[model samples]
Target: MLGLDKKDFTLLLIVSALVLLAPLLLNPFPEGSAMAQFNAGYPDLMQRFVIFGIFAIGFNILFGLTGYLSFGHAAFLGAGSYAGMWMLKLLSMNVIPAIIFSTLIAGAISFLIGWISLRRSGIYFSILTLAFAQMAFVLAASVLTPITGGETGLQPALSDPRILPEFLGGGSVTADGNIPKPSLFGIEMTASSEVAVGNWLWTLNWGYYLSGFMMLVAFYIAIRIFRSPFGLMLKAVKSNQQRMSYTGLNTRPYMLACFVISGMYAGLAGGLMAAMDPQVGAERMQWTASGEVVLMTILGGVGTLIGPVLGAGLIKYFENIFSKINKATLEVWFGVFPDWMTDLMVTIVYPFIGKGWHLTLGLMFMAVVIFLPGGLVEGGQKIAKLFSRKKEPETPGGEAKPAE
Candidate 1:
């Protein structure tokens, strides 16, 4: 029954409020605000935030708690996506079965991988996982062409089999029977509807809400794992495996369990991504995608409970927003400055902002690691402490108290 303490409860309340109000807050620029372009309430971007948040949270369970840096996590995610898609193609478009089967399959795959990879520790374990992930990527690209759809990616089509609703009137088959999109109850899970006010437009899609709800559930589970006794054992293993072994605790099973759990989380995220978008690409299993999750987890704060969420949001923001900037937009912003200064600035910054957004992200990540090793959460804590220090002298205990 390990659970949140009072402080943790307060934090959870705050985060819940934020999540609930995110759409409103993100869309409050009056449609013409200078920063309106940066607003994150759009269905696609918001979905990504929650999806990657799940990814980072899952990665945190392994690397943050058990001190195991897995370089092959993307494989589970890709596998889960493919599995979920196959379910959609072969069975009914109900998400429950797809998500469950995807998670279980990913867990099984992780168990096999962990059994082999756990034999090595440190860099060796990392390399083994990397090798495995690369192999998966290659196989998906070639050997698994039928299932994975090869280089063009797996997409929804009319050729899929629909085994549900066998008692249709006269057993008549409809065009919608094949390649059906997943639904909740009877509601379609596809993105639909657009709200436009003056020149501003916002899409209220079912996929966004579905993904958001899933992310909230994922966050709750992560919090539970962080506060659980099992989590403590994993942390102990991370700190000192030899000492844990000396205490008669078998660390291997714990580590393996953690690895499988983490893989399942990644798989869940991948499944949701496919469900929302109805496509699965081989690139999702690439080493670069795995590295992105590692960066998200480390950039936010490795061990802190909420840091991974923050990291996921930040990285995803940059990925979606910054990468969309281009030279034409730069010229528009530079209109405020002198021609020479504007030209100079754009020339210096253009490469890093548009297609080179990754370079900017890399530099910012390095800066965070160098200056705030505890991640953005530590910086926030420091700011809170600074404000609290300023107000403390006004309290009844203004006089210095003796140390215990």
Candidate 2:
């Protein structure tokens, strides 16, 4: 297939199918049904799934392959986001320029940070990254207030100059004098169409498809990197960087390169987010945001292709569906039960839903770490093995042989 071995090719096909059909797959429950609350086929949520999938995929490159657990990758994401926002404000509403400039700026920032941070390894390196991220957050919120818009964040306004439109022989302002939304050529990012299939409604979103396409490309690149010789070197670095250093192998450049690449990935995700929403906030660079990617990679299966995407979807699903289960929703779900019984059920389950969704996530993370250290992928493999039938040995007559 696409230069990949049969297994990798099959995996790629499966992912493509999933991404293409996500609106249908994520909306299995019929509209207005009780279970519809769990449906995540909406444009906003779908975009988040693929965008964060890209983030986790990039984080996995450095953490999974090179054993560099960054605690500040979100800085790159934030930087890219600001860059994208600037492009949107000063250039045109078209998302292409913003995305490209976002990537390049983030890569450059990563290169500088990696050059300094890669000097140390282990917890020290992790601490340095965290410090850098926190510094960026503070700077964005305070010192860089003029550029970042401080606590309010940066967003486009109709009054601002957009030179690209003028250069292209068009007015930047619409006839209605509204701030333009991000778009691809003539298509708006928020544009969507709906199809009704019986009681089910599916939303086909331009932004989601665009983000999904980017995610697929990012995934393919990650797969190639994983299977490449450079990927092999990264794995070797993970196994024994100190030994490689003793052997006169300059591991620093490899680590720095991986770090910059990972940062660029984060930046791209941030740019996509801005293109969708056209806003950039300092909060995007917080250490917690960086930690979330780490959790996504670990929960899905670090170093394994497709694990980060799976993990990202799971977490996003939890954030959207589980967190939305309020008392009213829970009551509706348990309406068939007796009043007292329904109340009891809600009381017991309430803590794990709504505001306490993180508790559920924490418990799940703990269970996976304890029981399935290889993450959800290992559990899936185990289930697959259990369902698979073992072939018995055959005799020369082509009949099953009896056990000796």
Candidate 3:
């Protein structure tokens, strides 16, 4: 189905189901409930979930399959965001053109960077990419102040001329003199519909749906690439680039292509981010931003099709949900206990949440690395294996039967 084998097609369906049903899945608690604070069905965090998922998915193509760990991939994301912002400012408030331009610009930048960085493999290449990213960051933050808005950042302005809207028979400026929000034709990205079921509330966001759709497409494409000869070549490069070189095979082109494709994915993610918020900052290109995606990929399960998406979702959940758990919130949860007990409980768990969520993430990462090197996916597989082993029937000689 959809050019995918049974397992891959099943995986695709599962992902699709998850993305489409995330609102319900992420919001299991009733509205106004104490646990409702952990609900992630809101548009902002949901959008981040998919946007970063796309970013990590792209990074996995390079780092996961090809063994090329880029320490500066966020440069492409930041570049794409800037490009998208420019599109919003100069062109119509439509997101399509901005997204297209973002991908193209990021691809071009990645091409230039890859052309130079791919010359050296391993740590040398990583350092080169990092240096270029740092240079880009500095330029965007300072040297390119006029264009990037310097430290002030870039966002839509009320007075700027949006030529496309004028040609489309609409005035660019709002009658209220407010900046226009990004949209698909007339549907604003911030627009959403809400449905109330009993005590539960669900928000269906247009922007999130759009981003989710793009993520689905991106995932499908990644699956195709992973199953193709190109993906095998990338795996080979990871396994032994020197061997392929000895066989007179030119591998630089493949590496560059993979790098550009990955950048395009990151670019699309950045573009969607701008479409949702219509803002750009030089901080988007920081090395920490790049490292975050690497961590997402590694934590989710690098080299596996669905691993990065899981990782991205996990990290975003920690960032959004766990980080929001404060003393007051914890006090409320433990309110039923004695005052001393509540205070003690808060003290015990305080360090892992509310401004120290990174500690929890670090601990989880360490556990994954030391125990399950394959990430959460491997952990899941091990659990499944255990259950399956228990389910197997015993043979006549008191041994488990091995049946096909």
lDDT ranking, high to low: 3, 2, 1
TM-score of 2: 0.93
Question: What would the C-alpha RMSD of candidate 3 be, to one decimal place?
Answer: 4.6
lDDT of 1 by residue, 1-404 (tens): 22778877777777777766566666766577776877787877878888888889999999999888999999999998998877766765666667777888888898999899998889999999999999999999999999899999987667566566633111123465544556765566774577777756666778777777777777778888888989999999889999999999888888899999999999898888888788999999999999999989988888888889889998898888888888988988998999999999899989899899999888878877788777778777766666677876555442332110
Q: Which run of 10 residues does model 1 get worst, by summed lDDT?
A: 166-175
| Local distance difference test values of all predictions, in order | 0.81, 0.89, 0.91
**Per-residue lDDT over 221-261 for candidate 2, one digit per residue giving the tens place of the 0 to 100 score:** 99999999999999999999888889999988888889988
What value of lDDT does candidate 2 attain over all alpha carbons?
Answer: 0.89
| Model 1 regions lying over 4 Å from their true place | 1-3, 32-34, 166-179, 192-202, 391-404
User: What is the TM-score of candidate 1?
Assistant: 0.89
Candidate 2 runs further than 4 Å off: 166-171, 335-340, 389-404
**Candidate 3: TM-score?**
0.94
User: What would the per-residue lDDT of candidate 3 be over residues 1-404, giving only the tens digit for each residue?
Assistant: 99999999999999999999998899999999978989999999999999999999999999988999899999999999999988888888889889999999999999999999999989998999999999999999999998888888999887767788544313467767777788888788999999999999999999999999999999999999999999999999999999999999999999999999999999999899988998899999999999899889989999999999999998999899889989999998889999999999999999989899998888888878787778888877766676677765552332222110
**Residue 164 deviation, candidate 2, in Å?**
1.4
Deviating ranges (above 4 Å) for candidate 3: 166-171, 334-342, 392-404
Best by TM-score: 3
